[model samples]
Target: MQLHDFYLSGNCYKVRLFLGLIAQPAELVNVDLPRGAQKRPEFLALNPRGQVPVLVDDGQPLVDSQAILVYLARRYADTHWHPQDAFSQGQIAGWLSLTANEIHNGVARARVGLKFGRPVDLEDAQARGRQVLELVNAHLANRSWLVGEQPTIADVAVYPYLAMAEEGGLELAPYPHLNSWIARIRALPGYVDLPRF
Candidate 1:
């Protein structure tokens, strides 16, 4: 397996973190996003989307960080990371949707704007981020994990952007439950830290 990665990308970090959690070995191929390497023809052959964190497993390419997380959980991890039952899968799906939509548009977008100088409404993004954070903090108030009593891909999918919220000018101080959840994830066996801004 080989992961086309960009170190500063929270999306890319998702794959790296999951691989560490499962103790899976994958060759790391750093994509020079700052130099437009991902858009080059050779790299586009792997993923036309021109995105980093494309995972090549046994010569098959997987695009999108969330998709890669799903693939890794299903192929390399135990059911604890991605349960098999329909209801549980549906529940996890909701969080994944939130990760892709709210989290991406909110916290992730804010980070991209502030850290990478991408044009975006920082105030709007931060507002949306706080809204999503409040929801997650409340949901986590009584549960150790998102989907069940154990960690899942849902947690992996949402953790990166939220954990890196400071780079987006969003603070975690108001959400103690969310902070605790992040700490719990950090303490998990085989966990890897994402680069802080």
Candidate 2:
């Protein structure tokens, strides 16, 4: 198995974190995102969307970090990471959608703007980031995991950007429950640290 990764990307970091938690090892192929390598024809063929965090397992290329998480969870991880029950599946899917939408647009975008010097509406992104911090903090006030009693892809999916929320200039100290949840994930066996640029 191989992963097309960008070292500074929260999206790629999530996949790497999940693989670590699951005790799976995949060759990491660093993509030169700053150099526009992702837009190259070869990379585009692997992912027409031209993004990193593409997983190639058994010669099949899986694009999109969220989709790749579902694939890896279903194919390699134990059932708990992605429960087989219909309700659990739906719940996990909803969190994945949140990761793709709310999390991406808010926290991830702010991080990209601030850390990578990208052009973005920094104020708006930070406002969105704070809102997500509040939402997740409230949700995690009495729960150890996002979906159920155990750790699932939902937790892994949401962990990366939120864990690095400070980098985006959004304070984590205000969200105590969220901080506790982050600690829980960090304490899990085989857990990995956030990516450093």
Candidate 3:
């Protein structure tokens, strides 16, 4: 197995975090984003979208962070990480969708703008991030995990950007429940720390 990765990318970090949690070993192939290596012909062949966090398992390329997370959990992790029941699977899928859409557009995009200097409205992104955080904070107020009792890919998928929201100039101080949730995730076994900004 191998992963095309970018060190500063939260999407890439999600895959790495899961790999660590499951103790799966894979080669890390760094894509030179600053040099536009993702747009290169070789990289584009792996993912036409030119994104990182592409996992190649048994020579089969899997694109998108959420897709990669689902694949990893289902293929490698125990049932606890990704339940097999219909309703549970659907609930997890919903969170994955939220990670791809709301989390991406809000927290991740804000970080891209503020930390990476992307051409985005930082204030708008941060404001959107706050709204998303508010929703998540309320959702987590009475629950330890997103879907059920134990942690799932939903937590892994949404964690990175929210953990690093400070880089996006978004303060997490207002969300005590969310902050505790972050701490809970960090306390999980096999938890690996991503590079801090």
Candidate 4:
């Protein structure tokens, strides 16, 4: 399998982290996002959206980080990472939504926008990102992991951006529970530092 991704993108890092956790090795083909290498004709043929973390397996391409995580869980591990119960699966889905909507939008977008010299609505993004963090911190107050007591793909899916929220100026100091949880996740085996996208 070949995973085409930008080294520093949080979205891309999510997939890489999952693969590492499962010990699934794949060739990484770096797609230069800032240089617009993803917009090239050859790359566009793989994904119409021109995004990173495009997984190519058996000549088929899978776009989007969340989708690729699901695919990896389904294809690689038929275990607790995805879970068996309907409600548990739903919970995982819920976390995935938060990762994509709140985490990805409020945190990832603002961080990337500001770093790239783009116009980022700092006030709006920061407020919304804080709201998301508050929600996550509250939910995590009584639990060890997001979807289940065990660390699932949902946890892996969301950790990087939230941990590095400070990079975008989103502080984690206020949420002690979140800080503790982030520490736990970081301590897990097979953990890798998120590469700058």
Candidate 5:
């Protein structure tokens, strides 16, 4: 198995974190996003969208971090990582969607601007990021995990960018529940460290 990854990407980091949590080993192929490696011909052949965190397993390449998490959860992780029940699946899918949309547009985008010198509306992005932090913080107030009793792909999916929110200039200290959740994820066995720039 192999993961075409960009070291500073939260999306790529989430995939790597899941692989670590599930004890799955994959060769990490660095795609230098800063150098435009993801847009090259060979890389485009691997992922037409030219995104990082493409997982190639058994000769099949999976694109998009959320999709990659679903694939890994079903194929390699413990049953708890992705329960088979419909309600649980639905709940998990919601969190995944949140990761793709709100988190992606908010904290993730802000990080790109603040930490990587990318262009973005920092104020608006941080505003959305704070809203996400509040929503998740409220949801997690009475629950240890996002979907069910155990840590699921939902937790893994949302953890990366949120964990790195302070880098985007959004303070994490205001949300105690969110902080607790971050601690829980970090304490999990085989948990991987957040990506560094």
Candidate 6:
């Protein structure tokens, strides 16, 4: 597999975390987002959206981080990453969707705004980020993992930027349960630190 992505991207980091945990090594092709490498005609031919995290396997490109996660999980029979039970499966899927739509769009984008030159709506973004954090905290309060008593692709899918919410000006103080969960994930064998976090 060849993963073409911006190295600093959380979306790309999700795939890296999964590959690391699954012990599946792949060729990492760094895409220079700031340099508009993803927008180039050659790269655009692979994914018109010109997004980071375009995974090419057997000459077939898989765009979208969530889709790549499902593909890797299924292809490797990654049982721990994606379980077999229907209910648990739904739970994972729900979280994956939230990671893509809510977490990535809301918290991550807000952080990028503040990090880059863009003006950040601090109040609005922080409030929404806190809301998302609270929801995650609630789900994790009594559980060690997101689904099926183990860390799944769902957990790996959302863990990167979230572990560094403070970067977005979202404090970690209120989400003790989530903080603890972050520690648990970090202590895992194949855990890799995100550069910003």
Q: What is the TM-score of each candidate against the true structure?
A: 0.98, 0.98, 0.97, 0.96, 0.99, 0.95
The sequence of per-residue lDDT tens digits that candidate 3 reaches over residues 1-197 is 99999999999998999889888889999999999999999999999999897899999999999999889898999888899999889999999988888888889999998888879977788888999899999999999999999999989998989999888888999999999999999998888897665
Candidate 5 lDDT by residue in tens digits, 126-177: 9999999999999999999999899999999999999999999999999999
Task: Name the runs in model 1 displaced over 4 angstroms.
Answer: none
Candidate 4 per-residue lDDT over residues 6-120, each given as its tens digit = 8888888888888988888999999988899999999999998888889999899999999999999989964888997899989999999888888877877678767666788
Q: What tens-digit string does per-residue lDDT give for candidate 2 at 117-190?
A: 99999898899999999999999988899998999999999999999988889999999999999999999999
The residue ranges of model 3 lying beyond 4 angstroms of the native Cα positions read none
Best by lDDT: 5
Quantify all predictions' global Cα lDDT against the true fold.
Answer: 0.93, 0.92, 0.91, 0.87, 0.95, 0.85
Candidate 3 residue pairs that clash: none
Model 4: residue 42 alpha-carbon error in angstroms: 0.8
User: Model 6 over residues 1-197: C-alpha lDDT tens digits?
Assistant: 89997777888988888888778888999998888999999999999998989999999999999999999998974587888889888988999989977787668867887776467676677777888899999988999888878888888887887886888888888898899999998888877778562
What's the TM for model 2?
A: 0.98
TM-score of 3: 0.97
Which candidate model has the greater TM-score, 2 or 3?
Answer: 2
Candidate with better lDDT, 1 vs 4: 1
What is the per-residue lDDT of model 1 for residues 1-197, given as tens digits with 9 covering 90 to 100?
A: 99999999998998899999999999999999989999999999999989888999888999999899999999999989999999999999999999999999999999999999999999999999999999999999999899988999999999999999989999899999999999999999999998875
Provide the RMSD of all predictions against the true structure, rounded to 1 decimal.
Answer: 0.8, 0.8, 0.9, 1.3, 0.6, 1.4
After TM-score superposition, the amount by which residue 150's alpha carbon in candidate 2 deviates from its true location, in angstroms, is 0.3
- TM-score of structure candidate 6: 0.95
Worst 10 residues of 6 by lDDT: 116-125
